[model samples]
Target: LKAGNMVGPRVYSTGTILYGADGDFKAVINSLDDARSSLRRLKAVGAFSVKSYNQPRREQRQQIIEAARELQMEVVPEGGSNYFNNMTMILDGHTGIEHNPPVWPVYKDVKALWNATRVGYTPTLIVSYGTQFGENYWYDRTEVWKNDHLLSFTPPSVIDSRSRRRTTAEYGDYGHIDIAKSVKYIADGGTKINLGSHGQLQGLGAHWELWMLAQGGMTPMQALRCATMNGAAYLGMDKEIGSLETGKLADMVVLNENPLDDIRNSESIKYVMVNGRMYDTDSMNEIGNREKPRLRFWWQMTRGGDMINLPVNNTETHLFGVQEGD
Candidate 1:
């Protein structure tokens, strides 16, 4: 996409997760040398950052952070719901913590410690730990499968299976709210709170995250900052991509409504601009900087009276992995 071969949002990924323990995608970081070598390999392959995922010992994780610093790469460690580990990562100079700490109603001690550093926090409230996910709230309240905008790009089979049968939870049972409250608390202390949807759904999940942030006591404008400027800063791209500044990349969403009036209005996207090229939000056809229509997805191409048979087991076939029966 960055090469302009595909039409979509600019994507930056670690390519493969770096694990410390025995699991799929392990990076073999049993020692400091291992950590340095592993990070060097990932950086060589175009990873601007590394995910130091669940390195058991503090020293092992620290080694990864140190290695990342040496390579000028950012280290985004997995929180794994461990408060102690998360605290240590923040103190040890990690770039950011990927998930919530899993503890709610954090006190002054937690906030004070986090505020002392610039380490970023991405709560990913949609899949908040130790509670019902925020994603289910929307599924229970909204007809997600009936959303014309979502259905335009996603396959009906995928959306129907997840949204049609909703998992209703008591209002209090939804843990993401409490988690979000903690997020707002720390954010008020000058901590950078980033918007992360945990890939719960395409495009819309981000709005869900932004709304949940507002539910935690943030003003609509503050919540919008988490979804935009804060995220760009966390990724070390603030100077080039965060706010609308002269000499910065022209990447922005043209919302139909002012989000400051209502956080939910953030999703009222009228147009999207990427690298100065403007596109119509509904059809994603280029309307500025060029004249072109969006290409058809594989599902749009008919195969003898039936839609193309999407790969059921191919993990890379779709944004979300395909299940066995799918």
Candidate 2:
């Protein structure tokens, strides 16, 4: 904010994780009063509430909740599989919970859950598991996502396909996050969902994260709100940058289609009005069109319009006869 050009969402950061010997940053509570004190201490420095990147068990987290009520500070507990022990972190008195959202049941009724706790959710799909989708069937859309880059980061050792009955080093088990189920679940729930594409892998993975959220369970309007309102609320900057209200930041997005009607229509963007300027999507697409033929020529030769059954070249495959001595 001081630089005058670092504009995105206003942020409230919890300085650092104060954890015990087990690296237990998410869980611990002697009492509610202690939780409140912890929140006040966090707020006194710079944060508006107490926040963490993981969740603890039910019994251990109670004290934090109790303390939060006493100090009138928000408590946000992030949830995940590897790190989060509790799924209902928001219900535990945290201002909100972070993403672990693969299930439709969880995303759809999330608003009700938030209202019930008076908190929010941060669906950071990109961070946790989006990139895990290696050469996934859906992402094979050459026009949308090319796989050349995948070959670079995706070594055989990086994959863990143990879930398959046969044990083989040939495949790594990562990718495809039950996205369809999750999308339907969250969209239908009509909750206050924010967009946070865990951003470590895909350069602009947030865009894809937001797109998936809309394609999975949110309308374009709903998904946009997740990127805007939901994120604003999660960051405690709702009054500042979440909406187009007077005195708020002059940021905007102009689209040709009603995303609310068809969330996928987001790809059909025409112009984007941001800060106070416009970006022409048509021009961007026009540039891409000129090079499309070059990119498609190889696929055209291999498949001849039959995309699904494209022949896999086996000339490179190796096979040898068993040794006679054996």
Candidate 3:
């Protein structure tokens, strides 16, 4: 896609999870050599960065970071909800922490320490740890399945199954709110907070992250900055794509409503532009600088016509903690 061989958003991936502990996707690094070699292989296969996931020992995690630095690649380590590990990652100079710290009501000392550092935070509140997930809050309150834009791109079966029969929780019980409050504190102290949806939903999940940021008392503008400039800077692409600056790439969303007025208005998108090509937000068809209709998805052409039923296995249900009806 980056090479212009396909029509899609620009993608930068870490390829696979690099593990230090025993688990499914294994790239176990028992030594510095193992860490170096594992990273080399990922980079060779076109990974822009690496996910240093739950490396058991401090030394092991440090080895991955060291190797990543040597390879001139960014290391985004998983938080794993461990306070010590997260703090150590900041001290050891990781590119960023992938998730929020599990502990809530973060104190001034911790916030001060984090604000003093250059490490970025990408609290994936949708699947946040130590609290009810933020995704559930939207599902309970909104008709997610009826979102036309979301349904146009995502499989209806997937959206309907997850959104129709939703999970309900008290507003105060939503853990992500407290997590966002801590994020706001650190952000106010100059820590760069980036928006991360954790793939809970596609287009709409990003907006959910923005709104949740506001729930922590951040103004609409501050939350918008987290979704835009902070994310670009975190990915080291600020110069090329963060804001609408001279010599920057022409990538921006044209919204019908100003997000500064109300954070939820962020989703009032009319058109999207990428690399100077404009697209209609409703149908995702190229409109300006080119005229092209999006190709029909395989599911759309099938006999079931967007109602395809995919079988869920016992393992998948157990792994995702899905109840029988859900």
What are the lDDT figures for the candidates, one per model?
A: 0.85, 0.49, 0.85
Residue 43 of model 1 has an lDDT of: 86
Task: State the lDDT of candidate 1 residue by residue for 1-326, as single tens digits.
Answer: 97889988877787677887787677777687998998888888899898888888999998888888888999998899888999899899898899999888899999999999999999999998878788998898889887777776777778889998889978888888999999999999999999999888989999999999998999998998888899998888899987999999988899999999988888789999988999987778899668897765665555444444443222122343345883
On a 0 to 100 scale, what is the lDDT of residue 122 in model 3? 95
Candidate 3: worst-modelled 10 consecutive residues by lDDT: 312-321
- Indicate whether candidate 2 or candidate 3 has the larger TM-score: 3
Summarize candidate 3's per-residue lDDT along 158-260 as a digit string, tens digits. 8879999999988878889999888898898898999989888888999999999999999998988898898899888899987999999999899999989
Badly placed stretches (over 4 Å) of model 3 are 3-5, 304-326
Return the candidate ranking by TM-score, descending: 1, 3, 2
All candidates: TM-score: 0.91, 0.57, 0.90
Residue 300 deviation, candidate 3, in Å?
Answer: 2.1
Using TM-score as the measure, the top candidate is 1
Ranking, lDDT, top scorer first: 1, 3, 2
lDDT, model 2, position 307: 32
Local error of candidate 1 at residue 18 (angstroms): 1.3
